[model samples]
Target chain A: MKPLLSVRGLSKRFGTRVACRDVDFDLWPGEVLGIVGESGSGKTTLLNCLAGRLTPETGSVTYNSAAYGTVDVHDLSEARRRLLSRTEWGFVNQDAREGLRMGVSAGANIGERLMAVGARHYGDIRRTASDWLDRVEIERGRLDDRPTTYSGGMRQRLQIARNLVSEPRLVFMDEPTGGLDVSVQARILDLLRSLVGSLHLSAVLVTHDLGVARLLTHRLMVMQGGAVVEDGLTDQVLDDPQHAYTQMLVASILPV
Target chain B: MMDTISSSSSGPKEHDGPVLKVAGLTKSFIVHAHGDLALPVLRNVALAVSPGECLALVGPSGAGKSTLLRSLYGNYRADAGSIRVHHDHAWAELVGAEPRTVLDVRRRTMGFVSQFLRVIPRVATVDVVAEPLLRLGADPAEARDRAEFLLALLNIPQHLWQLPPATFSGGEQQRVNIARSLIVDYPILLLDEPTASLDAGNRDRVVELIGQRRDAGSALVGIFHDVGVRELLANRVFEVSP
Candidate 1:
């Protein structure tokens, strides 16, 4: 199948520091690609490039969609990019707080996306927001509460709801499970597994945890110093460490 | 699960002396811009967070999480259902409470970390952190001392402690938000998504601090949507039903 997203020769720099250099990748529909690396390895930098949060100095991001047809994501009109971000692209941050407006009610947070896409009926927006809240397992009663009043775990869950409420075709999750506890992490992993299967959406997950990649990814990419060192099937690369860096990473994960 | 921790920090749960409580809470608004009609935002809902228990509320966008949080804080008055709180040796609803009573609840009992970190625009970090303490009538020297200690605990460099938090990074601003919420020693602490803009390292530090607050005897309720964050703090998770 033709890929949903394709990136070629992408590069980004901050002053003299190179964040991403000549990065290349492709994402197919319903595929989960895990990007793993140490701090400053450019995993997040690459995500920024993909999401258009950072404009790369060079390269192209092509999006081939059934509804919108093929277009270079990097070269789209500003209006088109806004539409894509508001309606088609979902970005989940490592910190849920970054993704949510803590000042608003949960209902408003979820409904805001629908409203952005021209959902004007109050009843419809509330019902839709309520439905998503239930999907994420929050109480309907708490929908009016400001996000600031919620706990850390609750905020994270709220962030997921905020992103997923829009029903994007592709989602980018940066270190989705980095700060969670074991049981909560397991539950979230299970939730992601089910959500992707049911929604039939593609995901680009960035993390340092091999366990997270092992649970949710179809493919894996190892990054170091702003470049990809290896890319392969998750099992293949995880089971038979070909590169020395990959071997160290595989060895570093605590045995479950 | 309850008895393994320290004793000096232990206190009664929020239910025993709930600063905020609601039963059959419901709210709605007239959408003048959206085809004339009253749209219900929250259906009949009821919940209470006990003191010292970090109750997590998770849901998709538009799930009314913020509405519910605001209702408890007396920001949005519910259309129906009674919100009652035990305040000043009496139980009363914060909605329409006397001004002094509302002020007292805000100052002496509950600390809210708003989504926007509303810090003084041009004040030093120590003063910003110490503001809550100063508001509660602490001596300036004592407040500054407490603020300095908290800044260190948050790993903010001593040099930055005397400077304006406005000049800090996103992560640094978030730490100040945490310190500001914690300085007052309020019995109940309400935090909206506290670590949204943080990088991985700073994110972990914030999570650890939330855990520390739970250990410090303050009843906490927060809205979070990150799976990792929910995993770390939610002793009980409530998912809004479809």
Candidate 2:
């Protein structure tokens, strides 16, 4: 089967510092691939490179888009890449505040993506937005409230709802549950698990939490010093880490 | 703990090779506050379960019974060994398999029913049970209908079907959890204390459900606390100890 996204020898550098190097893998459809590493290990940089946010210095990032067909992400024109971002792709930032418009009501936040994709009926947009809020477990009563007033978990869930409303096939998330309470994190994890399964979404999730990686990802890449040190199934990598860095990372997880 | 295995059609299930095989698995739990005191639990535990068999894990408390269950499910990081699961008509290593491979195995072949019910808050009880099918891309209506059927079979009141099971009694919650696990008809099933919270009647129903699964050629490995349930369901029992 053709992969939804393929990468080969992708490298990125910031001045003299290597941000990422020689990253290569294929993200299959409906698969969740997790990138795990300490801060500054280049996990985020690799994600940005894959998302076309940071242009790599070398190598190709190919996407087999259902909408645009097979095309190298970096080769796409600025307009087309932007179209791709607003259409078939979704990026969830580490901070919900950065990913969402705090001033707008939750309904509008979800509706904007639909509108960007040519959805214009006012009643239908409102209904769909409300439905999305429900899907994300946000109450319909909160649909009119600005995200700025919501709790951390609610805002994060809303951000997810906004990204998913337009039905993007692939999603890139950075620390989607990074700063939440443990309980809230479990709730969000559950929501994400169901969403991924039911929607058959293909995703690239970047998290330092091995627990999160174990729960949400299918394959895992352990990043160290901007290079992939080891990659394999999430359970295998966590349960039997072969690389010293991967072994250390797995050991670092506190027992619960 | 109790487990049962109804081996395959050959001389024995072992003749066909167990569908789930574990060998040389070892693990230790370290207590960090106590100066990293390592508590070694499972010590080179080995077992195999063939299709149409139910293998039970029976042992005293602290005998690492639960640990063995979790290790078999790829929940624990074993110090050494292999958990070879024969799925999709091939042997896939679980001890060090990739997350993608493990998830794929879980989706299509294996089902693990832990003791508790962990569901998204506020989702209907029937919907919670229907979710596995939904994730497999089944029609939402058909999935819900099958969930309703299971709930009815398990004696979940029709009036409470739309309400979340989070507020249900412990016994009710366990039944919901079992129904969810049984919904998938996985080729290999791992169950832990599935009937710990149920009454005799409901426990009997769970026994029948598991029996039906074994009859349908699904290999089951379970830890049942109830002796009656174990006797009714497990044809082969494997013992464990510290």
Candidate 3:
């Protein structure tokens, strides 16, 4: 089977400081691959490069696009990439406020995706928005409520519904569960797991939290100094971490 | 039934041939921060289990018993050699296999009953147990029915079926874990101390369930801490040393 996303020799640097260096991997369908490291490890840079938000210094980011068969994301025109971002892929940002429109009603936030795919009927759009709200565990009555009125967790859930409402096959998640309290994080993690399974999503998740990585990812790549130090199955990487850097990262995890 | 010892160059070969085989499998962890020192755990291990048979792994702590099990399940990558399982009528090489292939094999042919249940917050116990069937495209109602059947057989009361397993007692959680794995009658099963937390009655029920799987020709490998459980379920015993 062809990989949904293939990244090879991807490197990004800000002047002399390297962010990503010679990173390569293929993300197959229905798999969640996580990139983990401390703050400067360049995990987010790698994700941005994959998402076409950051242009890399060298190498290819090829996506087996559902609409545009096997295209290099960086080579595509700006309009084409934006088209893919909405129709073929979903990007869930770490900050809910950034991902969502605070001024629009929660219903409009979700209906916009369906509308992007040429959803034309008024009743159909509203009905789908209402259904997605329920799927993400938001109150149906809050369809007209702007995101500003929602709590942090509700906004995060609303952001997820908006992204997933379009039924994109691959999702790029940057710390989807981060910055939330432990209890809220657990709820979001649970929702994310179910959504990934039911939708058969292939995701590239970037996070500094190993616990979130363990719960959501099938495979893990550990980075240090902007280079991949280890890559393997999540449990193996966590339970029998092969690299010294991975071991230190695992050890530094505060015991729950 | 107790004569098999397979660490030697030539392992015990089942008459029908082993359903699972491992040869020259080695796994080590390198401490790159500690001047690149390597901590070797599983070293050149070889074993095989046949259909309708249960092989018990007996070893002291830090002897890589659990490591070997996880490696066979493709949780850990072996440095050298192959761990192959006969699945869907062919030997699928697990070591260094693609992640997707490993996942497919796990979904259809092999089952691992970890020590505890990984509760998904608000998911009901029955849905948790019925999940494998759901993934296989079973009807939701039919899947729930089978889940309820297994839950009852494992002595999990009906009322508890609607509740999540997170707050359940240790024994109950383990039973749910076992039921969830057994939902599909996987061709090969890797068990890690599955009955450790159960009381005598529940232990007997679990022993009986595992016995039924073996009787139906599911090759099994496990770590059995209880001597009686070992005697009742193991067709042979394989010993590992650190």
Candidate 2: deviation at residue A104, Å? Answer: 7.6
Candidate 1 vs 2: which has more TM-score:
2
Q: What number of backbone clashes does candidate 1 have, counting pairs of residues 3 or more apart or in separate chains?
A: 63
Which candidate has the top score in TM-score? Answer: 3
The 10-residue segment with the lowest total lDDT in model 1 chain A: A235-244
Model 3 chain A poorest 10 in a row by lDDT = A235-244
lDDT of 2 at A187: 82
Off by over 4 Å in 1: B1-242
Better of 1 and 3 by TM-score: 3
Q: Residues B142-186, candidate 1, lDDT per residue (tens digit)?
A: 778778777777778899987877668877888888878777766
lDDT of 2 by residue, A1-256 (tens): 7899999999999999998989999998888999999999999999988889999999999999888789999999999998999889999987999999999999999999999899999999999999989898899999899998999999999999999888898999999999999888878988888788767799999999988888788888999998999887776677656577887777777774
Q: Kindly report the TM-score of the first chain in candidate 3.
A: 0.98
Identify the runs in model 2 with alpha carbons over 4 angstroms from their true place.
Answer: A8-24, A36-41, A57-60, A67-69, A100-158, A177-194, A208-256, B1-48, B58-68, B76-86, B89-96, B152-172, B197-201, B225-229, B239-242
Model 3 Cα shift for residue B78 (angstroms): 1.8
Give candidate 2's TM-score.
0.74
Interface RMS deviation of candidate 2: 6.0
Q: Write the per-residue lDDT of candidate 2 for residues B1-242, one digit (tens) a residue.
A: 22332212111122266788889888877654456667899888888888888988898988888888887777666778888988766789988665567777787778889888865565789988987777777788878878888888889999999998878999999999998887776888998998898888888778887888887778989898888788877889988878
TM-score of 1: 0.51
Candidate 3 reference-contact recovery: 0.48
lDDT at position A230, candidate 3: 89
Report the interface RMSD that candidate 3 achieves against the true structure, in angstroms.
Answer: 2.2
